[model samples]
Target chain A: MSHIVVGIAEFKFAEPPHKLVTYGLGSCVAITCYAKEAIIGSMAHVLLPHAYSSSHDNEAPGKFADSAVAAMVQQMEIRDIGPSRLIAKIAGGADMFAGQFMGSDRCIGARNILAARKALDKFGIRLVAQDVGGTAGRTVEFATESGLLVVRTLRGEVKQL
Target chain B: MGSTPFLSREQVAAVEEIATIAAGQAGNALSRLLKIPIHIGVPEVANVKLSEVPALFGGLDAPAIGVLVPFQGDIEGNALLLFPEAGITELEEMLFGSSGQAEDDLRLSAFAEIGNILTGSLLTVLSSLSERVVVNLPPFLVQDMAGAILDAILGEVGTLSDEVTTLTFNLTGLEDASLVKSVLIPGSAGIELFLEAAGRLKTGR
Candidate 1:
């Protein structure tokens, strides 16, 4: 069983016995889409809510909420998995700076979370589990075979979402 | 976002010099505040992709004590001082003459104070570029993995551009250069201002 680290602004697909992980998630959100019957999964670690390209045709689609969801859906389409068969789990979007940021800066984490949810909904993927929104950082792991997402906080707290 | 690089060589060097001066002043300020010897080392400044910031610093999963100072006025930016565990211990000893840790609240304040002084000194120097720069707000202190701590700030930067300019330097005054790291993440607009200021300063205009 190998765990591939999906870096920020990047996404990857996995098969059985393979897992995807992302570390040091503060305001950045990690979105995971799993297909149970096909036993395949994809993960994206996105930095913002919207990509610069509304067409989702940019070079780095995995970097934003709307495009990451679109990228994953488009790839899954190639693998013969329909959008309805995809269930999603999301983690991160923590306010690591607390209330220290100025103006709208305070709500960046919440905004990322909302964007991820909205994108998943748009793609008709059911969001089954989520561990998000706090004052600490998190690292997440998704097991492709088990369809299990493990969200671990910096303080050593773990939640299997 | 474009194929064109965000900053040219001259621009990076100009920012590096400006940041080095500020970092040196910060070290001096910390030395005075803590009554200890402090030194500043050469800094690495560049315009880089937003996603690569955590990996460039200590790392994503490593534990760190970070102080974030967010400033706005003519330009917006974030200054972060990251202290390793060893540096924290040395700080405690400098203040109390012992390696023993202080109360949690006091320790947090001390760290926050360190950040305040660092950011304060940085702002003092940066005032040259833009007199309107305001850092009146108190700095925020956080202890967590390095990557997690940076993403919140980087997420904000992501709104402006895919690439951001960061100035990273080591506080050599500590036992090891790696003991204390300071980074300045300037807003997209700040970079242009820095280049323009650098050009002006170079020409003595």
Candidate 2:
């Protein structure tokens, strides 16, 4: 089995016997989309609530919540996977700095989660599970074959979503 | 290539000089507070594209403890200090004269003190350069995977502009000289504000 590493603002798609992983997700959110029966999946490391940079900037679409979900869905469609066939799960979005300079409503972590949820809804992708929002960082792995999202913290805490 | 040059040669030189000042003053403050002889080698300063930010902070998956001191005034910027897990114990031992178990609040405060001193010195030097006063806000202490902690700051600044001025220095004489990482990231706007205050920029007001 091989593992595909998704870097910050990067996204990758994979098939059976392959895993998608992202590390150290502080305020950033990682979204995993999978089609269980087909055993294909993708993951994105999203950094912001929205893409403010104009299209001229040629910025990575996976860097923002709204665009990442849309881009990931476009990838799924390009490979013959329908929106209904996709199941989504998200992790990360922790307030590592603990919300001082920004208010709770304005917190980036909170805003990222909100944007992710709204995007998933927009694409009609059902969200299965999530481990989001806190003061700790998270590293997540998604197994395409098993359709399991494994979330782990630096403190040795692990959860299978 | 589309936008004009981010900074002039003189302004970049100004940034390097101010960073050198910050590194020296922060090193001295840590040495005194920790009660250990400390050394700061040549400061490493860079003006990098924002896309390279994730790689700028090394050891993404590794655990780290950090302190963030935010400053506001003529310019807004931040100073971040990071230590390896073991550096925490070395800090505790050097700080209270023993490694015996201490309350979490006490340990946090002790580390905050280190942040306060180091950040205070950097802020002071920055003020000296701009000839404009700035104030240091309360410090934020965090312990987690290095990437995760930095992502919070990165996410905030990544959208602002494409250029980032980063300055880093290491503090030797601790448990591991290389374990201590101190960085200053004055975002693009902050850089313009700095250049303007220093009379190096004449484009806008």
Candidate 3:
């Protein structure tokens, strides 16, 4: 099986017989897109909300939520995968940085989740499922060949998103 | 033992200076990367209490240890920059741009670099201001704050015991906003440099 390691702010796509995995998600969010016709799927791990400028773009153009979504859409476009046909599944974005001593409201987890949703809506891709926003961390895996998503978190909790 | 207090004061001031520079540099770097302005601050001296950090973030079992930076002159006293559990996500976002599913060490690599940059930049500024100092060895990424400190650090350090205060700067959306400005200085280290720098700018009394 072909395995793809998606780095922070990075994204990739492949047809069947390939699997994509990203590990150690604290507050940053991860998104996976899949389509059966072309049998193509892609994933992105974003660290920030938006790309401030063209100068800020990097190898992992999908590192920011806004830009990453566009990056994924662009990848799909290149492969003739229509945006309307793709199903989106997302996971990660836990607040790994919580401390009772720092007070509340510093929790950026909720904000990350909200930002991801808002960004995805612009693309018209249906969000089929999500596992997000908590005090712990998470790891996510997506099998594009099967269109299955597995989310693992600190409580040893594993579920399909 | 007789010179412990004296040594403590000097070390405190040194750390304070480090904090001011670190705060400034970190704010600057993140601003450049995110295009959003960030501000950093440190607590003042009289308020540098070692026990306060654990008390503030401590559970019955989670006793945390902290590093202290004492302020000197316009920046007198110490301020504690405690890293909490929630802080991890913030750091992750700042470093990786998307907190994706990566191994923990890989996730922390970016933040460790940030801490390195903040600390390294602060040391560079301090070297120009007074005595030269370096925080050799990389910053250890820890899920457990107190446990990490006790395990990784050497010697003794203090904390910003009193209220935590932050200094903010408008990097964007401001007409006359200053770039290369000092954001915050705590009670620890040598904060007088901030006042000194401010006075040089005719913004101080």
The best candidate in terms of DockQ: 1
Best-to-worst TM-score order: 1, 2, 3
Error of 1 at A99 (Å): 2.2
Lowest summed-lDDT stretch of 10 residues in model 1 chain B? B172-181
- Top lDDT hit: 1
Candidate 2 lDDT by residue in tens digits, A24-142: 89989999889987789989998888877574246677888888898899988988889899999999988888876457543788899999999999989999999998888999999
Error of 1 at B73 (Å): 3.5
Reference contacts recovered by each candidate, as fractions? 0.78, 0.72, 0.00
> Which 10-residue window in model 2 chain A sums to the lowest lDDT?
A98-107
| Model 1 clashing residue pairs (backbone) | none
Cα lDDT tens digits, model 3, A10-86, are: 68886778789776565567888898677788888765566545545443466567778888898788878778988
**lDDT (Cα, tens digit) per residue for candidate 3, span B103-192:** 766754544554445544554565445433423233434453332232111111212111222232222223433322212223324344
lDDT minimum window of 10 residues, candidate 3 chain A: A99-108
Model 3 chain B lDDT-worst window of ten: B151-160
User: Which one is best on TM-score?
Assistant: 1
lDDT of 1 by residue, B1-205 (tens): 3434568888788777777777788778778877777776667887777656666655687777778776777666666666654345544666656766577678778778877776676566656764445553677788887777777566766665667677776665456533355566655545555676677667765
Cα displacement (angstroms), candidate 3, residue A67, comes to 0.8
lDDT of 1 by residue, A55-154 (tens): 4345478888888999999999999899999999999888887876524734677888999999999988999999988888889999999899999887
Off by over 4 Å in 1: A53-57, A101-106, B1-3, B84-100, B131-133, B174-179, B189-193
> In order, what lDDT does every prediction score?
0.76, 0.75, 0.52
**Total backbone clashes of candidate 3, pairs 3 or more residues apart or in separate chains:** 52
